[model samples]
Structures are given as structure tokens and as C-alpha cells.
Target: MADIVNLRMARKARARKLKEAEAEANRARFGRPKAERLKMERELERAARIHEGHRRETPGEEA
Candidate 1:
């Protein structure tokens, strides 16, 4: 029981470390700021708006 508990803790710790590393890498690459986030959101929304009319639905599938 003690070994199993220890193993679980070790696995959780490793996963947490990996997540933190990934977040840091993402921040470094993308440089998250409020302005940038808003800009990205607006760009995505514009793309969706532009493509809305171009989507073709499959037969028998109700969108």
C-alpha cells in the first residue's frame, strides 16, 4: 500500500512538471498579452464569419 501511494505521487509530480514546462514554452513562443489574445480571437471570428457561407452540409445531416 505504501509503495503504491509513493508511485502515484511520483507519477503525478512528473505530470505536473511536464504541464508547467509546456505552459512556459507556449508563453515564450506566443507571448500572451490581453491585446494579443483579443487580436487572435477577432481574427478567428472573422475567419468563421467568412467561411460560414461556404460550408456544405451532408445529405440527411441537419445543421
Candidate 2:
């Protein structure tokens, strides 16, 4: 004979597992160190500056 299980407890446990899995996935997708994020931002800013420097026509000036 199979052992009896509490339905409510089983349901709660399942929900907890699903939630934990989603949290793990979110962490992997978006978790980054502060220093790494800052470095990425700096690199993007530098690239943008270089791009703007190469442009002959400014946005406000008429050719």
C-alpha cells in the first residue's frame, strides 16, 4: 500500500518549487555586479562619444 500524503502540503511544496525556479532564472538573466554594470555603461558612453565625434553635421546645425 502507498503512503498517504496531505494534499495541501503537497500543493504548497509544488508552488514553492516553481517559484524558486523562476527566481533562479531571473537571477541568471539580470544579476550583475555593480562594478560590471558600471564598466558596461562606461564602454557604451565612450562608444557613443566616438560615434558623435565622427559625424560631420551636428543635430542642431543646418548644412
Off by over 4 Å in 2: 1-29
Over the stretch 1-63, how does candidate 2's per-residue lDDT look in tens digits? Answer: 999999999999999999999999999657988888788889999999999999999999997
**In candidate 1, which residue pairs clash?**
none
- Judge candidate 2 against the unseen true structure and give its global Cα lDDT, from 0 to 1: 0.94
RMSD to true structure for each model, in Å: 6.2, 7.5
Tell me, by lDDT, which candidate is best: 2
- Give the TM-score of each candidate: 0.44, 0.54
Q: Which stretches of candidate 1 lie over 4 Å from their true place?
A: 1-17, 25-31, 56-63
Whole-model lDDT per candidate: 0.85, 0.94
How many clashes (backbone N, Cα, C below 3 Å) per candidate? Answer: 0, 0
Per residue, candidate 1 scores C-alpha lDDT tens digits across 1-63 of 344468788899999999999999998768878888888899999998778758697458897
